[model samples]
Target: MPTIVHEFDWPDRIVVGTVGQPGARTFYLQVRGGRRVVSAALEKEQSAILAEKIDEILDELMAGEGNPFSIQATTPVELVDNEPLEMPVDEQFRTGAIGLGWDPATAQVVIEAYPLVVVDEADIELSEDGDGVEAIVVEPEEMLLVRMPVGTARAFAKRTREIVGAGRPLCPRCGDPMDPEGHDCVFPEA
Candidate 1:
């Protein structure tokens, strides 16, 4: 497992962005605080899941009491460095376990990313009585953590959804992503 190189409790900025064009894009989660900045490469699906989970957590929080999710639209969330990531991002590991929660006391959303660890059926064990043993998954070293106010999280969720959704739409014929040059459709109309 790659060690958690860095962890920021309250990053100055956390945002998701793409490097390439729609069809040929590379999604990245970047965090910045003061003079330090770290960017990790992740798959598009991971980006989508991250955004979805964040929204779900925020929605659940708003379900109770007054609407605490009403964040302003013009929240300041500027990306510190806009320069494209160096030729090859070193630690481009697929994201593993992600944790999200709303801290009512601190009034900030907590987001964490762990190194993705694949578990196999053989890894699971059974108890002495043949009853399935509860498999315990220890939390891996966190890739990064962001404890930001509601507005920051809201802006992040909104921008993430937009960035992930900005990809090319699926092709009608083959159900595959269509490129600007057009994809070869297998199910050509007869």
Candidate 2:
């Protein structure tokens, strides 16, 4: 019989940690001393986040040791869904999670839109079919921004909105995406 594994439980001894990436829709986590497992308890929207967190954790573990660890011990150390595949982020999102603010002392990014915010933003070129990224624009959260085609801008905006509605992959506040490992938001008090 074909084995269908929906989700697995973590062991009692496994420890859990989190990893956040910039502009990523889901929060990646690091689970220590556990079996190789996938989850499906989360909704379609959550599939991306869980997969991202798991991949990140596993990658780190593999990179550090140069070998895949055996997933031993099975029980829930932390909450995780084993189903639902996360949506892939476009190339333009490289700096999508950067906040809106300009640092006078630092450089800035170029935005295609006018009156750009001070936060970091990326410029993506859309193709006629409008699926894969044609090109990318990276700039600081200040000064000169890039220019985009009308159609491309519209598509980019729509994607950005989707990420935000998904609970933001980076800091809870500021709405900036974090690195694959995550970033500490330094937003100042008002």
Per-candidate count of clashing residue pairs (backbone under 3 Å): 1, 39
Please write out the lDDT profile of model 1 over residues 1-190, one tens digit for every residue.
6556567778877788878788788787877789777777678888888778876777677666676656443434552233444444455455666677877778788877766777676765444544755554544554766788766777777778888888898888777888778678889879
For model 2, what is the alpha-carbon lDDT of residue 30? 17
Task: List model 2 lDDT by residue over 150-170, tens digit each.
Answer: 222223233333433454355
| CA lDDT of every candidate | 0.71, 0.30
Q: Model 1: residues >4 Å from true position, as ranges?
A: 1-5, 68-93, 118-142
Residue 37 lDDT, candidate 2, scale 0-100 = 26
Model 1, residue 54: C-alpha shift (Å): 1.7
Candidate 2 has its poorest 10 consecutive residues by lDDT at 8-17
